[model samples]
Target: MSGNEKISELDKVLTQFNVFGRYHCLFMFWSFLALASNAVFCSNFVFSAEEVSYRCKDEGFGNDTCTNMANSTAECSEWTYEDPNSFVAEFGLACQDWKRTLVGTMHSFGYMVGLLLVGPMSDRLGRKLSIVITGMLGGVFGVARSFTSNYWLFIALEFLEGAIGDSCSPMFILTIEIVSSRNRLLFYILCSFGYPFGGVLVSLSAWKFTYWRTFLRVIYMPALLFFAYLFLIDESPRWLLIKGKKDKAIKIIEKAAEKNKIKIDKTLLEKMECEKEKSVNFFRLLKMTFESKIILKRFLICLVWWTTSTFVAYGLSINSVSLRGNKYVNYALTSLMDVPANFIILLSQNYFKRKAPLITSFLVGAFLCLAHPFLPANLSWLSLIMYMASKLMSSFYFTITYMFTSELFPTYTRNSMHALCSSLGRIGSIIAPQTPLLMHYWSGLPSLVFGSVSLIAGLITFLVPDTADNSLPDTVKQAEEIGKKGDLKKPAPDFVIDKDKDCSRL
Candidate 1:
């Protein structure tokens, strides 16, 4: 058989097992739990580290309740927070604005480190093991974070939580690898929903528990549950196949077929041949990503879009605390926007493909964000509406970017590229918490920056190729070829397998 024919046969064999079976559903359940846990942990600080009404301690102050201290010139000798159990109250981070931002910054920095470490680890070790280890470690650290009394120890635990908790990428990659090509996009959309769902949980927890430590304990509880369930899931068959564990891969496929109630001839498994395993170190993956101009172009475009999406999405989310209203309602509404965002993507992905929706989302989100500063001071309601709209649109942009970037790369390098882009994207998140600080410079400066970057990213979205309905490429060379084809004007049809012919051959 020709090389192309061999690749086609492999794709056919892989998709033969029902992708939407009970097994796949079980996998997605575990994946969503992990994803949502990470999301809650990531956003929990928005509430936990919130600044509360504080006043300086002085002899003249009435029971640590100094009124009109906002205009006071006296240095705060000691601070008393409204919520005595809040991080600020416990750590005395009041008046030290940098420390407040550092709480989030450290988490993001750890997330970047996790991405860098976990990506290569996923490639070297199986995806399931990597997630299990990281998930358990993240859970441990998350629980530990609640027990820390020392400020620096809390910061270190937060860093560890970010490092271990942010293993969403590997779990995501595993979901993609396990499902059939036609069903991949649907699963991706479903998985992306977990993030906002997590955000909603965070808001609800904050509303229920006024104490930060208690809230931390609540959000981290899911991780422990997820860790127990991790043992029930199987390793990705594709990963096993690639690693030359043919017998193990065949058994997984057989089990999936059995669970899905499909009867297949055992002889068909004998036809499968493992490809020569390449040494896929980080440097080799990096070299492969940039060696082709088309791939390089796509990577650069995606990097910008991912970075901008994360920046705007996280910025708007974290900045909700500063909005003029009940912070709980503002946060819950912002997080709930993901529901419509996911619906819009699912509804529009077929008609708009990848680039159109992304561009439109970015443009709309940018307009709303940019218009925030110009709204009348008396029209706070309108300002809130604009902020919610911006959040919705940014959420839409963020969700689709994950799908788009996944489709742009070949299977072998997909996780590596995703990790790299996500790590780079963390720069935006790291900067997002500090954006509220920018309000000190100008009331609208942060919004202006977010809107401007999103606008530029929208323009760059035009350069990205559409991979709608296309089969995933198995090699880097094939990926380059797909990129060279540019925007797919016509949707590719799904791969169909000839069961009778395969059975006869077997």
Candidate 2:
């Protein structure tokens, strides 16, 4: 932590602006705004695409819900929906659970492709363009979706918006690049509240609007306004400096300082511009990984960990709305659980070794979920308690694993490896929507699968190396030697491309 080389030159200059920082707060607010909109955008299925209760007219069974019509041999051509305002109600998807859940699966498919294109585009084009373009298009598509009654068109829009419009990852990178190193964790923790806040906002909006089309248009209204971000915020000066746009980067810095009512010297900026990052070739990294025993073992293990984490985290989120209670309250509670999990991760960063907390959280959470189906029918409250507690545990390990994956890899290939694991991890989300369909097979089947995956993920943490207190490894040698008793060199750049974040977008 004492190494001067570990701090980037841009970070040093930005430290002056971090005090009495109006500019910092202003831009960070914009980032969270994107996050908020992104939350409601990704979670539309919780209300709109969920199965609604309905009764169909049949000669043998009169006014019985489709779920209650399980054993009846009668086919009902006409039906009455209890909600009158969900996708199921309009599309006649009452008896078809998989069709009801297909919207969520399609959305996840688009999100996976978006994550692939956005990161490199943010590097090549500017953050402002990425954020603004994606935001505007996402809104356009979302608003367009409101006018559609065809299920095929609705799902197509879902895919289009996801692939082209997700802006949160770019916004997240912009925030990290602009803020000083010391405040990164605090800034991230504060801004992270946006997702949960957005979830509550969605719940309230849906409750008030009561119609899927009305709710869809209402949330996307704010996204159309993101075009202002093009002029309102500065391009990340750090990125500009790295990309050799010194004059533009300097102008941004001077503008930031001027807005903060401070002065900066021109010579200082020029001096810092000379620092260069090592060029990374991803193809070479593949060769290096195969040559190192520990590195290869670590990468393979990360595949499992990342996949299981996404499966459990997102599966629980989807299940929250399906729980036997007020659906809004269930989702709000599950979303809010992430707030404490974020803070706990920040607090524990200095106090404990990372492995124990992660392992314990996954293991204990799995046990809670495993016990969810055994309680008596009268003890609904206890069952709810177990479900919520399990979600809390999932939040803990889910947040922690982002950092843990970064710590496990060598610097030159870290971003590439993280991206690979995350993309594959999308498989978990791809399958999560179908979990509700599992209930038709057995009531307890979904919970059993969630707990079983969590248990396997928890047990596998013992196989990979622990990275607490060790300097970040910049080479295969250092990565292989992680967790050994020694002071390793911090050879990588101070700034890392942070890939550990909400799987909702990236």
Q: Using TM-score as the measure, which candidate wins?
A: 1
lDDT of 1 by residue, 1-506 (tens): 43334445455565665535566666666777778877887888898888677766655455445443454555657776777777888888766778978989899889987888888788778788888878877778888888889989999999988886666878888887776665666667766667877888889898998788888887786676556645687887667766788788778888887886777666667665534347766688678778888888888888898789878999999998788878888898888899888878877875676778999999988898898999999998888889899999998898888878887776667787888888888888888888998887898898899999999999888876767765566567667666455422224333333333221100
- Assess each prediction's global lDDT (C-alpha) against the native: 0.77, 0.72
Error of 2 at 397 (Å): 2.2
Q: Give the number of the best model, judged by lDDT.
A: 1
Q: Can you give the TM-score per candidate against the true fold?
A: 0.90, 0.83
Per-residue lDDT, model 2, residue 312, is 82
Where model 2 places Cα greater than 4 Å from the true spot, the runs are 1-7, 14-20, 62-74, 258-268, 273-299, 353-356, 404-419, 462-506
Off by over 4 Å in 1: 1-7, 13-20, 59-74, 265-274, 485-506
Count of clashing residue pairs in every prediction: 0, 0
